[model samples]
Target: QGTRELVGKVAEALASLPPVTVYEPEYVPKPPVVDTSEPLDIQRLDDGHTWLIQGPWLQRLMANVNFDDYESRMWFDKTLRESGLYQQLEERGIEDGDTVSLDGYEFEYQY
Candidate 1:
């Protein structure tokens, strides 16, 4: 019968379809040798800012100043300026207006 033939053809067509495949990614392990013995380089800049550098890492600290209020801004600036870290950076050749680079990125202390 034509219906039986058609059914056979349909079943054959479905059987001819490619098999479905699921991919699983291979895991890669991290290297065993990593160096962390070197000391980090610290820099202090004028304007109550500090910069710390280690290898490709860098940290910058800036005073939190309230820009909308003049008095709050003044207080924040004064507090940061008196910080020992800020003063040390100033003594270590980082000028008040200097840009520092870490991990290929440049940063400056700006309020």
Candidate 2:
């Protein structure tokens, strides 16, 4: 009786998982070369950090969710925003800033 009850509970838990489907979505990768050809500028603003060029560049507008919960989060935010990409990340996911292969395109992100 004990074993049967355990098996039933396990079955119920497993059944809660989602069903798999074959509908795969298309994923466009980022450009092989950013074509930036120029170094980005870094700035320490009063609020958010800015890393970009005068004309074109990648920009990350970050917002700290919980300032007290984690110190690493703040550190990472500061570190990455000061990295090379700045606003030129290959794998960026800032809502509209979806990653797209920059195969020979000369366009900046505009909302």
- The lDDT leader among the candidates is 1
Residue 54 in model 1: lDDT: 39
Segments in model 1 whose C-alpha atoms lie over 4 Å from true places:
1-64, 100-111
Off by over 4 Å in 2: 9-25, 38-111
In model 1, what are the clashing residue pairs, if there are any?
A: 44-89
What lDDT does each candidate get?
0.49, 0.41
Instruction: State model 1's lDDT.
Output: 0.49
| Per-model TM values vs. the true structure | 0.31, 0.24
How far is each candidate from the true structure, as Cα RMSD in Å? 16.1, 14.0
The clash numbers for all candidates, in the given order, read: 1, 7
lDDT for each residue of candidate 1 in 81-105, tens digit (9 for 90 to 100): 5444345555666765466544334
lDDT tens string, model 2, 11-82? 999899898778878773432222334565433223322223342333222232233546534553454455
lDDT, residue 71, model 2: 53
Clashing pairs in 2: 29-101, 30-100, 30-101, 31-101, 31-102, 58-87, 59-87
